[model samples]
Each structure stands twice: as C-alpha cells, then as structure tokens.
Target: MTEYSEISARLAALPDAELTTVLQAATVGRPAFWAVRAALDEMAGVGHIAPGGDVSPTTESVQTHDQASGGGASGQVGAASAVPVVPVHPAGIPASPAAGGYSSGGVPTFESVRDKVEQRFGTAQGMGELDRQTPAGRSADEQWEAREKAARERLDQIRKSVHDNDNP
Candidate 1:
C-alpha cells in the first residue's frame, strides 16, 4: 500500500545475505543514508536512542520504540518524531565499545590492501562452479582446485619476496 510497506515487503523477501549486501550498497554516497544518520544522531543527542554513558550506536534496543512510533509491522518509525529514529545497528553485529569509535585508525597501506585482497581471493577461489560442466577439459572441481593451489603458491611467493626485501 505505502512506499514503506512495499520496501518492507521486498526487503522481507530477501535472504539475510542479500539483504546485507543491499544495505551495504545503499550506504555508499547515498544522501538518504546521511540524512537518516543525522536524524539518529540528533535523537541520540536529545536522549532518544541512548541516554548517558558511552553511546556506542550498536547497543540500542529499538523494537518497542519502533512499535510505539507507528512502525507496527515494518519495525521502522518513518516520522522523525517517531520513537524509531533509524536503527542503531543491524542484528547479529556485536555492539561497539563505549570508549572510542570503531576504528583501528589510519588509512590502509597498499600492502595491507593487497594482503586483504589476496586473502579474500584465496578464500573464494575454491568456491567455483563445481556443479557446472567446465569446457576446460578438466572437471570443475579439479579446475577450481588447481586454480586455487596456483593462486596460493603465487601469494606465498609474493609474501616471501616482500618479506625478504623488507628484512634486507
């Protein structure tokens, strides 16, 4: 019926991983996200989200708040004045520490980025389409395994080279 209802329906239909991916994509440079974030910050400042002592955004409990604020089904208070002023954080993520913002500090170095990419690649390489028939003369699982092994070997060699150079 309403736009929010439609969005809620669609979101409800998505699996958890897909919903997470969708939310992540929505946060990138989106004006709507920033606006809601600002609203939530304001709510926190005035004591709606959390009242005193180390307001980590993740520790808020808003289900009852959402229902009170006219978000009976969707679990989101659409109006800014509504008790649900944007969710503090999604479910399952651990609450942030109270003392400092969630940051390890400083920009990531190229080496760090490279290492992360390689790690992710290594993790996913074995997850190739094993069910699908490969045109590559080899079975899909064999192909994937071979590719993963080669990639791991390459990463190991690169790491060794970098380590040797750093020590030298």
Candidate 2:
C-alpha cells in the first residue's frame, strides 16, 4: 500500500476524539497533516461526521468562484461545489466557529490543553526532577528568579518616572 493509504488507514481506525486531536496537533506542510485532513474530509464527505460533532449529514452546496478566470461566463459555469453544510444554533451562532476558545469541532484547542496541563502540573518554567536534583540547575533557577525580580523593579521605576512626567 502507498504511504498516504497507510496513514489514512491508521487515522481512520482512530476514534473521533483521537482523530481530531491528531488533526489539531499535526504540523502544516507535512504529509501527516495532509493525510489527517484527507481523513476528516472523507468523513465529512460521507454522512459520518457533521458540524459540532453531530452524526447527521449535511446537504448544503457552496459556490466556488474561479478567480483566475476573472469570473467570466465560462468561469461561472459548473462552479458550484457541493460541501457539507454546518448547522446553526437557535441563537444565530454557528455550531462551531474556528475562532471559538477552548475547543472547536469537538477538538480541544492547544491553548485550552496547555492551560489544563499548566493547572495540573505547573508551568514549563518550573524545574524538572533532574534540575531539582542538580546543584548547577538549582543555582541557575535562583539566578533566573533574581533577574526576574530585578526586571520587575526596573519596570516599576520606569512606570513611576513616566507617571511623574505625565503629571508635570
């Protein structure tokens, strides 16, 4: 089997949540990203997946304009592309907007996942097990803390200076 087919098979075997996670984590400009996108597109093409993680099929057709052809008479002909339609909520909001915080299309956003990780295990700036055990790492951490404190003080001084200047 071809590489794409192999990848597509693996992706298709994954559950929806896992597949969405892989799709979100995939880096652009890579074969894996394209494969994941194709898998989702296939799901959408079939009636298996719908917006907001619904199982219903979409029947909306979107128009595709050929901008390269200057949208002339020929360009307008056969330009309609059939795509899955997203369902809208009663409040006039889309079921899943790409810019929505936390999650989109039932996939947790990177920021949301990062925030959860940080809450559970602390931020990346915290020292790791190896760092905590090493004298050099401990010293480095202390130095970083001191530098940050000094920077905060300097920023406060600058803010005070600016405030005084504005008042005068």
Candidate 3:
C-alpha cells in the first residue's frame, strides 16, 4: 500500500480519545505533528494535504484579490501578491535618512571600532587606576611591609624551635 494510504488507515483505526492524545503529545515542529495534523485535516474534509504533510487551503477557501474583485479571468495570482514584503536593516541603525543628510556609508570608523571592542572585551580604561588604589586605612606598600615583617618573625620562631629540639 502507498504511504499515504497506510497513514490514513492507521489514523482511521485509532479511537477518538487515543487520536486526541497522540495529537496533544506531538511537538509542533517535528514531522510526526505535521503528519497527524494533515491526516486529521483530511479526515475532517477541511483542506487538501500536500506532499511533505503540508496542508494547503481548500479551493473554496482560497481567493486572490483579482478573483475577489472580478478583474482577472486567468485565475492566476501575481508574484508580489503571493508573499509578503518586509524591510530589513542592521540593528541599532535607522531605516530612514538622518536630519543632516549624512550617511555612514557602511564604513567603520576608529571610534565605532573602539566602542565595539570595549563593549565586547569590557572597558580598557580605569583598570590600572583601580589596581593602584590603596587599601582601606593603610597604603599598599605599608601593608606589604607589615606582612613581610610578620613572616620573618614566624620564620625566626620556627628556627628557634628547630635549634632547641636539635639540642635537646
């Protein structure tokens, strides 16, 4: 049997509740959802199922502007009418021209490049200044010296303990 006939038979054999459950469980984007939806649509006589399980509008439902207005006897839709037209532009760029009649001409400036780099890698300025800031209540150099003195005192205490242990 043809694949389409097999699908129709399988769908027909399913109980209404089981069919509904299968429909509910099917994901939107996958082939299973499209196949089930197409079968259901065909069984209901709502529309014709095209190849690849795409549902096309019924002859009675689809009417072009020309046909609606009784203008064209050919019954053919124009290329422009078949699909929609959308305007696309780069992000953050205006679709219309500016007030001064000046355009960036799609050229990258040093300032623009630097701003993009800063946005991606974080701000390059003020980092060194942040690193050089003194600690609270004391300069960094003084804090380093204090730490060094403590370490030396601890080393001296360890050495004395070792020397006393050796003698004992």
Q: 97, model 2: CA deviation in Å?
A: 35
lDDT, candidate 1, at 34: 49
Q: Tell me each candidate's TM-score.
A: 0.22, 0.26, 0.22
**lDDT of model 2 at position 122:** 61
Residue 79 of model 1 has an lDDT of: 31
Model 2 segments more than 4 A misplaced: 1-127
lDDT of 3 by residue, 38-146 (tens): 3443332322344674355334332222124543445664211332212223455444442122233434456667668877665445654565564642477678889
Best by lDDT: 2
Distance from true location, Cα of 42 in model 3, Å: 42
lDDT digits (tens) for residues 1-168 of candidate 2: 699999999999986645654664563345434434545444433424445754655344322221133333545543333543332233323444543333334455788687788876864545476676699888988999999999999999999999999995
lDDT of each: 0.52, 0.55, 0.50
The list of candidate 3 runs beyond 4 A from truth reads 1-130, 133-138
Question: RMSD (Cα, Å) of candidate 3?
Answer: 23.5
What's the residue-level lDDT of 132 in candidate 3? 57
Better of 1 and 2 by lDDT: 2
